[model samples]
Target: MRAALLCSAAGSLLLSTLTAAPATEDRTGAAEMRGTAVAAARAKAAGVDFGPCPDAQDLPGRMQCGTVSVPLDYARPDGKRIELSVSRARATRKDPRRGAHTVPRQGALLYSPGGPGATGLYFPLIGLLPEWKRIAAAYDLVGYAPRGVGRSAPLSCTDPKRFFNGPSPAPTHPSEAYKRERVAQAKAYARGCAERAGDALRHYHSLNNARDLDVVRAALGEERLTFMGSSYGTYPAALYATLFPAHVRRMVFDSVVHPDPARIWYRNSLAQSPAFERRWADFRAWIARHDDVYGLGGTAWEVLRGYERASAKLAAEPAGGKVGPGQLQGAFLQAGYYDDQWPHRAHALSAYLKGDAKPLVEQMEQHPEAAVEAENSRAVYVAVECNDAPWPTDFRVWDRDNTRLARVAPFETWHNVWTNLPCAYWRVPRQRPLDVAAGPGELPPTLILAAERDAATPYEGALELHDRLAGSVLVTERDAGTHGLAGGPNACVNGHMEAYLLQGRLPGRHAECAPHAEPKPTAPGSRAVGRSR
Candidate 1:
């Protein structure tokens, strides 16, 4: 999920001075189909041509992979089409428990890994983990590359090497000049995407993604949608349920996007700025507590000073030349998502200050080939975000809003703004934001999880989504801030999730999980997701 956003920028310092299409082409009349509805009622869903999965050898069940073709434009239904890569980890049996359960296991659990851009063809592989055991037993875990992501008509905006691996500007204080630079690069990137993507940009937003998702569901021959998605993935999943509510059996949205139509995406993206700032504060405070281990600072302010000094050193002479100031900040961003990363990253910073550049440099390494995938992720992220709804055409609105926000909560504010700045110059028609509150028919009980302190999809979203979707359950992870709560460290949350998926009901409509333990000094854990550029 971190990689979904962190790497989607595709370029670290992409800036210049400052950084949408029309109606009538009516492809978004495609959106008139509701994010992913098949406007042509008679259009038959394509069948998936299942074959052996390349990476399924390690899993217990026979994992199958195939491609399903869907309409490139739902409005044009049968006129043209695109492919979606699909995977299925077949459900072998129900829970072989010593516990008594009478309800029959339900249908496939269509899964997306939280990216409006993240590659998800392999998500079914999560069933191999112990945490997913009962889930795997009760349902066929279905995974697919949502439209314009990964192998499914993937979007590409610019040359990968230049956009992803090129040098970034110094992470110095934002001056007028620095702000102008970001604007220029943002325009350049947006223009590049429009020039490169052309007509294809019109078909990649959430509505079309939703339309394609239902086509995939039909291809799998499922009568109802039982789904699980994280972060931005929840947006389309919610749309699918709304677009085709009668077909919705069950759903689990982990770290969800708010669906008030008012928050569509621009406001949603901006909301993350402050959340990241608070999470960063938590990391700094954690560093302060572990001063005995890190010896960098005894207070949060002192710790931030240590980081600033390190950022300055890296800006002048990048550790190992590859890990620059951008790389340093990228490393710090990980602590905003997962607290367990605090110790290792803090140590890496400490080592860099002591002249052990290898720790930080190695932490920031990237294989050259990865740049292409990063470009695809970024392209889809840009296309979807920009195309999902209208953005401020006037750069001043962007400039004012971001400037006001950054002044108070500086962490990630500018970096995040530049990443999505392409939206201001989008080349395709922007759809009216999808209304995900209700479906054509009654919606099923949904399980939405969010950590109170989660920066990616803030707790407000979960609360809002719970309010909009009547009878849905909202589970809070108290005092914790991690994203992607399903199968996470909190057993209480996981327990609620597992019980919901397997038995189709939770103990209560509203629940909360206590915070998971924080990490010990130097404890090895999850790696930082994505990197600078």
Candidate 2:
């Protein structure tokens, strides 16, 4: 995971630039409390608490780990509750240069680490980075595992090994047999979830996640919220902003998700197929430019043929009796998310074609813990996405559309289909996506960042979100493709991001950031890294 995607506690503000926000009355007691008959269904109810964090002795000030709780269903606040694993780090240091105890704390920043399922108790670890050091002095940092995530009443369908290590149908061009297998797999997976989790799956959607944010805010005794979310995290952050606009002090959404009616998620994922194909070309082209070093191909087409050949060989005889065609493609998929890893992935591919499979096998992340993490992330992803909105229940609608998309964009169309097909058979009833525009209190201006060629979340999604949230500013990285833009290599994007969080000031209605140069190959003494315009 990118450390940048995980933010920590807030810190000292550039006093000259920081603006203090007004206090809003705490609304903890504002929401009506209901009956207690359902209390038996819950584990212990919890409040925000902080204490020593292990293995973080070197951290500035101190890092704390604790627990908070939210109802499984907000409609019944006093009902069955689930625990939230939370971490905190306060940037409440005194500075004499300004004045002793002169800087009042800026509101703590609540961070979401991209995965709707990603465990975020590690959010404060981002403070380990030098870039966030100055930013950390302004406020406390808060991190949590949302409901149904790790350490937060986690939901699992079956023996995770079956879901993680089980054989998968070829994601490449699939036949009717392959399609049937996938449909069955998806159905079984959904059924397993129901058997294991029961009605709990219904509460795993984003609206509830947003609702839980309020419980967290009230627990912290803060009147307002200052939030930063990345990737899928953007979805919930936007929901929190719209559903509770008055409580928002500031927000930053990086690599925005487009949850509009036309392509919110079902269609949105289909779009990623083509986007990944385009990004694959970028990776292929880069490899072609360094043909002499890799000896794989002299052009993008040639490089692709090398990949196809490798996939065929792997499919016939799994590399090291483990990595198959599915593993091969999965290894390369990382290039679509972060270009910085391109050189590394390409080298792995190169080594594989030359009859050495070590590098390629490593990309599969063979560690026992890696499989566990992947399974949990996948479970949460399916639970949240399927429960969030409606999907055509008919497998034919999914197959027909994905087949059409695969004809033109074959890189990940079917692969993505199988990954999300579980949604079609999802047992939970779906709701319409919430209107992410301003709430009744009216939202303040927000800052949104997008890479021009983000494969996971297209740049246009950011533009769409900019339109949805009135007064929000949009920052574009002209030619980049990384998934999380803020706290990335782009200094310009981070400048605007830090300023917004620190000063609560909005940049221009639209801002443009130049993409940094593609990374130089890391082959020994190959070349010194250079910056691109």
Candidate 3:
């Protein structure tokens, strides 16, 4: 949730540099409409509105909380009114001084937390990145949950635990029966979501979310929109630019996702497994050196075998009636996102291997605590991923792809499959995915940041996106393993971002950001992963 993954009212520009602009009155048609909807939706959805300018009285300008009513289906916009829960913190420095009026209206920024499900309505609260406060000072930082996500009309499936702790598509034998069960479980999850969510499910597409951003913009009364999109949010930002180019002012897409329609994300993530396995190996080697602390394995190979054994143990008897292959794999996926958390995972693996069971038990306990948030997570994730393109209904395809992938990348292949298995059964109707190579849709100068070694959204994907975004400047965090590449606070990456957001300067067409120095030892006082957040 720290990265830009949540949805919010309107779109935004990534303003690194600042400039002065006129401070207008507090009236906004967009704000008014949003306010009305917020009041109404709050009555129905029981969402918190937080009203206007709550704690910002100390600040200079006003902020508001509200919602927008969108259709359950874009084709039938006039049909059922699906509520988009939203919150806004308007420009605070706009009216402080006359000479500073131009600078006062620092404009606003819209952020996305990428889950299509993660909520960022609390961007300020999330305190994303140590430097975010500086960014928020000049601009209004606004965020919201997409439909079927936090505070928004959420989706809940029966036997929700099954979603987290079910048997995945992986099998040691890779038998036809295994594939059948995988497909059945996937399809059942999809049907369960569809049966409960119905029309609400259909409208959760990224395109719709992008359009909802427009409505948010209109409601906010902003002349233009600025955005920071990561992961799946990149799709909506791209789509919004294509659908309404004029509305966009500036945008930044991090950890870019392939907008191609032909490939299912399940397939794409499978492709990433090898890369993650590579990262895990690196982690395991490090853990070997620190065996005195972890004791899970005496060598990298031992640690590797330990994880395999843990997976086998879970497959035989899921921990605490949960933490099956899916949960274990899902947890690993989170761990793999960055290097700082590797120790946490290593410790958990070590403890589990020793049969202490506390760490793994602790991990399972955290799941139920996040149940509501997890639903929001699953809802938004499936909504956008499912709608982006049609997934093959044939379970045989998934079975084949996953089984083939698990051969070399056994780490999370089946686990990844089960994590995304619900997509095969997504209740929402499908739409065409965006073309990654489709040139940027008349966007303002955008900064594209990519890790040279990102596994989730591979570096090549960024290169592809850069090629498509004619006005964008691409920078590579050379050899970095993490996706998105922003939180390192490296002088090369952060300086470019700061220069862009504050000065509106674009790096040369292809900028090469210096790689971070070899990471300092992970002992105490070292810069840990997500330290910025």
- lDDT of all predictions: 0.75, 0.73, 0.62
Residue 42's C-alpha lDDT in candidate 1? 29
Question: Model 1 compared with the native: what TM-score?
Answer: 0.89
- lDDT by residue (203-311, candidate 1, tens digit) is 7888777777777777777777788878888888887777678777888999988887756676777778878888899999998998888888999999999998988
> What is model 1's C-alpha RMSD?
5.6
Give the Cα error of residue 205 in candidate 1, in Å: 0.3
lDDT of 2 at 25: 15
lDDT of 3 at 225: 81
Worst lDDT 10-window in candidate 3: 2-11
Clash number for every model?
A: 18, 8, 28
Provide TM-scores for the models. Answer: 0.89, 0.87, 0.79
Model 2 ranges off by over 4 Å: 1-47, 53-61, 92-104, 166-169, 439-441, 524-533
On a 0 to 1 TM-score scale, where does candidate 2 land against the true structure? 0.87
lDDT of 3 by residue, 304-344 (tens): 78878988898787777656665666666666666656666
RMSD, one per candidate, in order: 5.6, 9.8, 10.3
Ten contiguous residues with the weakest lDDT in model 1? 10-19
